[model samples]
Target: MSREEVKLPDLPVPTALDADEEAEKNLTTAPEVPVTPYTPSAVTPWSQDSGVATLTADTAPGTTVPVDDLPIAVGVPEGADPAAIDGDWKVDLAAPAASQDAGVSGMIMRVTPPADADPAAQVSIAVDTAGFADLYGTQAAARFGMVLLPNCVMDSPDSGDCAADGGTTTMSG
Candidate 1:
């Protein structure tokens, strides 16, 4: 018995890449971003001189839309490069459930905890993102999230949306 020889498929030669063009295509420089500055507004009179802060102006007529009403940001955020991401990332929000999260691109995926006994839910995200390299912040590490906001988990899941219970957040790290 004789074995038949196998022939390897012919592969095309890769063209040499121009450093300048390659750098440009890789988005070394971000596109122009618009700046929207916040303007100060006049303070409203207090209902009480001293005590709990209460607005004297009638704000009851104002309307508010439900958080659940808004659609999820399933689409990649403006200027985000989904193709740039290529790794599994895990962020421990330390909550019973993953309420909500937003990033440059992709979705938050619930992952099985390393240990079944671990009650804390785990979620997977994507790192190595682009389109936000110009943002103000120190990127000491190679991998970083362009933007991630896992909303506060409410004590009662049935109460309302996570955004509703996330009351009074004046500062964020």
Candidate 2:
């Protein structure tokens, strides 16, 4: 006996959306969010009301100021009283002046070693803006001296690597 083969109808894939169905799916609705006005406050010194700086530690002898509450002094000459200075007090004006000295002609910043430090080994910070400008170009060197008392290292004494304590040297010119 021979068996007969039965054929089944192919079903359609459902991906296309009808306009009415699409409109309902993408319906516009206004969200009912509560509206409230935000009031802003001003930032003032530690003495100001509602200022963070106004809050201080209770157990201190004097006014225990917060880290952010400390005042800054700017524009005053070197060794000036910090309290007497005002207006963007943190700004530094005295940068190491550039030099053309035969040795390392650059901005020289003198740093006094601690009194207890080796008396013969004082350390002075020096920056060679010209050398930097020559090597790295002005774009990179322009802001080189902006940092206050920038740390610098020398390959040798001619580059001001020698001890800043003014030690005598036997090497002749």
Task: Name the lDDT of candidate 1.
Answer: 0.29
Worst 10 residues of 2 by lDDT: 43-52
TM-score of each: 0.19, 0.18
The Cα error of candidate 2 at residue 70, in Å, is 20
lDDT of 1 by residue, 75-105 (tens): 1223433223212222222221222222122
Q: Residue 133 of model 1: what lDDT?
A: 31
What residue pairs are clashing in model 2? 73-89, 74-89
Q: Report the lDDT tens digits of candidate 2 across residue range 1-173.
A: 33456666798888996567545566577988998864323222122111112211122222222223222111222343323222111111122222222133233333322234334421222222332343333344455452232233212333443435334343582
Q: List the RMSD of every prediction in angstroms.
A: 22.2, 17.6
lDDT of 2: 0.30
